[model samples]
Target chain A: MATREIAGTTVEVNDEGYLTNPDQWNEEIAKVIAREEGIGELTEGHWKVVKFLRDDFKEKGVMPTIRRVKNAGGIPTKDLYELFPEGPLKKSSKVAGLQKPASCI
Target chain B: MMKRVLILGAGTAGTMMANHLARRLDRKDWSLTIVDQHKTHYYQPGFLFIPFGVYGEQDVIKSKREFIPDGVEYIEQKIELIEPDSNKVRLGDGTVLAYDILIVATGSKIFPEEIEGLKEDGWFKNVFDFYTIEGASALREALKDFKGGKLVVHLSEMPIKCPVAPLEFTFLADWFLHTQGIRNETELIYITPLSEAFTKHNCAVVLNYLLEEKRIHMETDFNVERVDETANRIIGYDGREIDYDLLVTIPTNMGDPVIARSGMGDDLNFIPTHKHNLQSKSHENVFVIGDATDLPSSKAGSVAHFQGDVLTENILNFISGNPLKDDFDGHANCFIESGFGKAFLIDFNYDIEPVEGTFPLPVIGPFSLLKETRVNHMGKLAFRWIYWNILLKGRPMPGIKTRMQTLGKRLPKIA
Candidate 1:
């Protein structure tokens, strides 16, 4: 496991730099991770996706897919890409403190 | 003096040619040698299934030596240059190998760096390509936690190996996302430089309809100029921009660099080949096959398989002082995986477009042409087995002819 300091908080990451443990994720850490992903700050739209992903992952023990986030989280399909540029699920799931999704490619 | 036959790149085309020529040519009259940089032989078609976990790492890799016949010498070395005039090739180790006959089968490769920002910041992180083993493995991990957004499958340019692969990936993505219950949330888009879903008009019509049925957006004639990693968008040469949450792109495909260095190839390093005879236009002794040739054929494995038979016959004819048969009709057969346990099979040649019909047999086709069927899916699955055991061995498949068959094809009505 690789470890990185996001907003002064140490987080375990996989080989691809995705969060290995979702339990250690915090809002501050997500902002820092977003900055690292080239996004300056987490907007209100970004938080909606991040919170939905985190809440759903905690409840279902699995990360929420784009459909789940749109249908249950009330986020539109276009807004997801708007909030998280280039690999919204990957970037948002990482910000939400979840493991990297497998097989999107 | 023994007639020496040298084959470059012991991949699909070269390996099959080595096996085919070894069986046909006289042992006393010819000595065969095949050279490749890597000792491992990868089932490249299986790379498509890797990200989906349908094929494991071990399933695609095998020793190149195992495929080479006993009489053929296999050299694991990089080819430095091909001096066609001298009838010899220079190896990376400075050894010169002279040949009476040469076969160039060094296939095409993805040039990601050719596109601006393609190999920059977001490469392998946000932007992923499943064209290679490492790329596929990395993509597999990326897909696991994907919540979803705009999943764009882009083709940087045409003349790519397995032209249907991107379509297959797009279709499979739909199935995968739906299975993960994210299909409705994700916007699936396929962007190609071509004006339609595919190169062939008839096949494109069917494929376009399927794309509409699956709710996948098709962006045609999208000639990508650059990728803005920071903006998460792909910009076209015409200033068209498509935003994507995730992008799977097939970069520009180019032939082997050795061909360019040898000055024996076209602008893209593909050997100028005779479309019907498979012989190099510049050098009579040199024959080109697979993706290495500048022939108007799909750069797919099936074309290589068909070319293998035609090339072997022509090479023998050239040696025996006989007229070469122009039998190679650019016959290409491809099985398109349309997801949901169904696939479409198409058979066509240089002159004919993909039409609705049965393959190999007239009335009774276990496989349907230009139509999706479950049995076509089975045939697609069964091909991987056939590739290793029969295709690689250069053995003839029963009831399958090398040339395109028009026996059962229902041609499209002329307008």
Candidate 2:
């Protein structure tokens, strides 16, 4: 079992190798998970979007749109767009360790 | 009594073996045959640069027979199976090729359909991959007309060829979107099953910083469950889902299907070749190389090139009834594109992971190991040219050695 702290939250990866708590997921969590999963690197912007997705999921029971996330997460739309430039619907969200959202289509 | 050599799938590895063997064996001594269903050959690594308009589709494709030696017989048919014990190969047309030496270079296949729902609803509609010529050309069209929305790149699984390709796509997409002035309209995401940007901790550290600088969002530890194309979402095993307007994915890559038919492959159709000797464990006269072998490393062109050298020596030794040398150290080198027209190089083997060091020579390196530079980017582009002319010809590359050496590599200084 491995334990890591992401953005002030302690996330525990159990012996079964699953991240035990969903709340422990954050930007750092995304980075840690990326390393653990063989995907490389998570930036601060990645954290901002992942955290937004986590928070959005908690609040609305749905993953927020990239546009919705930009405003809600306090990140400028341009920065968010630039961060994802391809749009935030694909593997970027997966790499952030955020749960897939239904409205992602 | 002439010796017969049957080469499977006249791709890079198969074609190179045919050319090399043709030069090695006289017509009086041996007969060589190259088999492939497709008439055209493709430069696979160039697929990565294609969607970015760096390399056109036409630039990467050529006739498979174009590079094969004139003396080598080219068989245009699908392989049915390999009877290794009997030293016989069965073709789709019921033709049997009896061989004294068999080389399995059938390479890999993209099974996007293997992933649940990946090919179901939004396969070509929204989901795309650049690993193939058709996929790349389609992705180019998708990227050209794509105005905003969420764009995602996913690595279906590990051990895929050119592991850094997804990250390169992310960076290039950023560059592409920015250039088109639609940078504000889109969001880019990169999802993978890996813990970091790369397998190596050192490279991951550098790439992590770069991802931050580029503002590319990432999702780690995502084991994709299904691609809900109808709903336009990627669902994970953990019950999370990502919606996308466009999905560029490196779908599940498996060994060539012919391996399974030949009863010479593992669960994924990858041939179980001896890690060191590159020989088929089931048969003495059979050998495997390139993406076909179940080796623990990135399935890149360089690895195939290195394996070619080792297999060449081992094959000759087997012919002479000499003790075979397991000299292949699993050496692999890759040029990583780090966006902004810069790339990085990493050279390592099975024993030594990629470390921060100068490549080729000590004190001065034409290309920096684990560090991004324009020179490395140029080198990445230059490899396509070399692939066609020098590498396919089985000619020796200057300053590049098949075995990995760690002389000038600097160990990380601990505090």
* Positional deviation of residue B114's Cα in model 2 after best superposition, in angstroms: 0.4
Residue-level lDDT for B256 in candidate 1: 94
True contacts kept of 1: 0.00
Please write out the lDDT profile of model 2 over residues B1-415, one tens digit for every residue: 9898889988888888887888876578789998999988899888887887888988888988889988889999989888988999999899999999999999887898878888876766678989989989888888888889999989876667777788888888888889888877888888987767777667788888888888778897566778888888998755568988999999878898878777787656778678899998788999998889877766888888888888888888888899878888989888988777899898888767678778778758788898889989999989999999988888877888888877778765555
The digit string of per-residue lDDT tens for model 1 on B304-323 reads 99999999999999999998
Q: Report residue A25 deviation for candidate 2 (angstroms).
A: 34
Q: What is the TM-score of chain A alone in each candidate?
A: 0.91, 0.52
Worst 10 residues of 1 chain B by lDDT: B263-272
> Model 2: which docking level applies?
incorrect
